[model samples]
Target: MNATVAIIGRPNVGKSTLFNRLVGKRLALVDDTPGVTRDRRPGDARLGDLRFTIVDTAGLEDADKATLAGRMRKQTEEAIQDADVVLFVIDARAGVTPLDAHFAEVARKIARPVILLANKAEGRAGEPGIYEAYSLGLGEPVPISAEHGEGLSDLYDALREEFEKLEAAEGPSEEAETDIVIDPDADGEEDDEPAGTVDRPLRVAIAGRPNAGKSTLINKLLGEERLLTGPEAGITRDSISVDWVWRERHVKLFDTAGMRRKARVQEKLEKLSVADALRAIKFAEVVVVTLDANIPFEKQDLQIIDLVQREGRALVIAFNKWDTIEDRTEVWTEIKYQAERYLNQVRGVAMVPISATTGQGLDKLMEAVFDAYKMWNARVSTARLNKWLEGVVAHHPPPAVAGRRIKLRYLTQAKTRPPHFIVFCSRPEQLPEAYLRYLVNGVRETFKLPGTPIRLSFRKGENPYANKAKKKR
Candidate 1:
């Protein structure tokens, strides 16, 4: 594992800001509101030339053992335990509150090294807190402005000192740390694996209406209460991601807040939560829309599925709380019928009946997830695509448009992962929308790619040398 650094602090102490700064991406959500982040998020961080794994954790809070804040503290403690170095952050503008001191005491007990960071220290704003941080028994605080990107060089120096000591203690290594290298023009002949391997983990997001047991399902999959779950409708506010291995495949599971309809989402926090959930869906390769078995396929549920299809992501439908139903066979048949009748945009979507509380039918759900993802990334050779296109045209040719028959020359796939195809045709703008849908449906059925969005476009191909010939004339 890469060296781990954990950032810990009280709520609104700029931990997420520092994390975003180091990682050079807005992976974590930042807001003026406290407790916006409720989970431990990990990312690869770089400081100048130094690189390491950095973890951004929820702020420590004092609460009873069973409460949500208590669970968040538990996650923070776990991050501190696994971390090689702890970056204890404080809001320099606020000047070291009682909560910061409390968490600092806990950090001091740990055997690992700790570095105090007085964030928001731009233009001498955090000078008082820098001095106050010395009383916490940690080393001198490194003043930093996480928002403005200031004082990072000094922080880098301190981190480099710690890493140098670690390197000295662990001795030297002859082999390189990583074998992967970027070469834009290199051919594929040197690689040993015949088929390319997907090194990046598959990103799957579980989204649905409130109280659909989305978090409960992922917690069961992880075999731990990694996320906060309860009877509350809006218990989850952030789109939290957990890294897991399922059947030896690395999968990054994102559990998003329950998405409510636009008219009902009036609260500011709920709006933010819904936006985060939509962002998760956009980032995900496959989305499993969970439904309450008691009230399956509500208008909001169909709207969520429609959103996923419109976003061009592969989809799987999951019926949650299946153990509550008395007549299982009849409900299952009805649900399938409704899925076909209602979700016409994404045909042949995999639907699995699962009880998140009881852990029943999870295996089938995962199998369906993997199957849908495979179809989403599937690609067809141009030769086979053209042959299929010929058959399709021969069966049902394009009708006459304004008295002349429109000719479609050929079709070729432009991309995969929601396979996109472009057809060279005459009068592309005049091609009817129904004809395009016909071709898209044909592609889906012919390629066995079901439940994945397929894009088909018609383009009039122009001769490349025509411009040059005209100039010569």
Candidate 2:
């Protein structure tokens, strides 16, 4: 991977589809719904012989001051600035919407070269719209059907041209920079647990809207008021972190400042507080988004889930103040349903209804955390995976595509942390979502693991290999 090519566009324009195409993996979710993607999704991209780093970005919406969309816009702009080439995608069939124009205008400000991609252009329906995309004023729209694997030759040509320009002028893009800033003796207060007892302690960040029991949960977990909590909002600031010992396991716990809706955060201190909280999330492996049981579902809460998915981190959603809810059963069901409905990108997210006050379900919460952590670290033996793959195909066969039954040749666990398995087969694109879920559910059931996010991607290939890549992180 050399050049950093960012997949950019308005919502639902197949940017993620093209990213997966080049990356040779379903690393990002592909849904028909607009604004499905909400964060910077970086993948090791291979466009034939041209290997480059591709960043799949959220749709750029013209958001007003103090909104989730506004925050996303800020993040997306940062990604564009970092990119070497911006692949501006537009939905050909949908024909340039108003938002498309807005995005194109915004993209012109970036110093990098921008190439327009007219996606979903396989059929006759998209011909006129593909031609219409020339109005974006970047360049000729490279018509591509990302889902059907059409029009990569043109994309390859465009990439080659950009690389040549950079080589001739900029003298070959620099090596991948080390982003980690190791502060061996960074001036900071100590956490609860001793430092050296653990090997790479899991970084778990706790976050939620103001007064959402985030500090309370941290206090409860540490068995002390390590972080100050108050009825007044914004008690914790500066993103205070501590090392925690849970059942002999060590974790570096980041108790972040309370994130409020941007509008209410008028003061300078509050804005810095929000930024500190965001930084905590960036440095976390697993984020425990503690929600107020009474007021759980908010726009900011959905944004938090979006952040977790974007960061590619395992999440354990803890509904705090569970004891306060009057109709426990009803509220719990409703909250879970809403979470599922809103955040569907990461399948099977671990959601626990627990009270941080009384410690009821904290044991279950810890148990769930361990399960999620294990799932994150889960590595299936290749021999065992293929063996189980054979059994799954033999038992409940893949459903018919048009007329022929889908043929699944083999399977391999690509990567894990929520256990991502890839099945190689004939007509993988045609494979039903129900069939894929059936296999994923089967794998979870077979392993006796439930409630952890399990991702099973069906690809049309045999034995894809990463030569020196280890099975587990």
Candidate 3:
């Protein structure tokens, strides 16, 4: 296992900035606002020849145990316990505040090796703060500027020493070797591979509005308090991804921040969180949009579902908090009616009612997710598609446009995973949008592709007689 390093400090001390630098990417959200980070986020980090798992945690703060700030502090404390080393950072330009001193005392009590980082010590202004940090009793301060990338060499030396000590105590680790064999007798050619059957983990992202129990659902699935949750809305800020196996199927689940309407989202931090959640949707193969059973099929819920369909991703609507509702029969009937009414564009989408808190309907939710994944990756042979197309066209021929009937000559699936298809037709541009929808719906129904997005395009068929006539001339 790689060495784990956790960066902990008071709000606005550049812990996230240092994390981004170590990871060599903007994996964590950075802002000038205090307490932007709320959960512990981990990323694989590399510095020179050294490699380790670096964790970016929420700023350490003092608050009531029931409050949101207190919950954030708990997450940071957990990171400190899990890490092999702790980077206790302080803002050198601002000098050490009382909160810093208090956390310094807290860090001293932890058993892990603590590295005091006097961040923002790029110039003479930070020199006094660096000296002040020495009074914290952790050790000599390592002056480094996390933003401008200064004094990392010294920081690396400090970390290297700690890691060397750990290695000595734990003993050397053996490296695994992978051998690849090539076939010399076979001709080199790339073959079209099928989808959904690969050994890689299935990427499933859970998204919904605030307090929709997205984090709770993920925590229940993980069987641990992996994510910080409370009665507070928007407890989650970053889109955190967790890896797990469900019934021998490897799955990478992304728990995204709650998305609110644009008009209501006035803060820049909330905007960043919403953007992160949208990115998770784009990366996921299947998105589970959690909905509160009390207020099912809200305007925002439909909008989120529409966005997923527009992004050409497989979608499953999970009505969370099912245990809270008393009228099961009436509510379930209304849910089905509303789903059909609002989600007619993507017909036959999977809707599962689940209680994330009680684990009720959890099995059904997973089954729906896997089913949607399979449908998303479903592919059809060209022969079968064309044969299906013949029957479709014969049953309902294309309407005449400008006294000429448009003909669909052939249909072929361009790709799977939210299946895209191209149709060779006459006057492709003249095909009406209504007819296109008809064809898309036909494909969805005929191919048993429910809950997954379908893409259909029309292209004018190439005429062989035109080239033949030119050759004759």
Better model by lDDT: candidate 1 vs candidate 3: 3
Q: How do these models rank on lDDT, best leading? A: 3, 1, 2
For each candidate in the order shown, give its overall lDDT on alpha carbons.
Answer: 0.87, 0.76, 0.90
What is candidate 3's lDDT per residue for 67-129, written digit by digit as tens?
989988988988888999999999999998999999999999999999999999987999999
Best by lDDT: 3
* TM-score ranking, best first: 3, 1, 2
**How many clashing residue pairs, candidate 2?**
2
Worst 10 residues of 1 by lDDT: 189-198
Clashing pairs in 1: none
Model 2, range 344-429, lDDT digits (tens) per residue?
A: 56546678888878887887887676667666667778888788888887788888878998888777888765577888788888
Error of 3 at 276 (Å): 0.9
- Cα deviation of 339, candidate 2, in Å: 6.3
Candidate 2, lDDT over the whole model: 0.76
* lDDT of candidate 1 over 343-446, digit per residue (tens): 76898888899999999999999889989988887888889988988888888888889999888888888877788899999898988888888888888888
As for candidate 2, its clashing pairs are 191-243, 376-417
Off by over 4 Å in 1: 168-198, 266-272, 381-409, 461-473
Q: Rate residue 123 of model 3 by lDDT.
A: 79
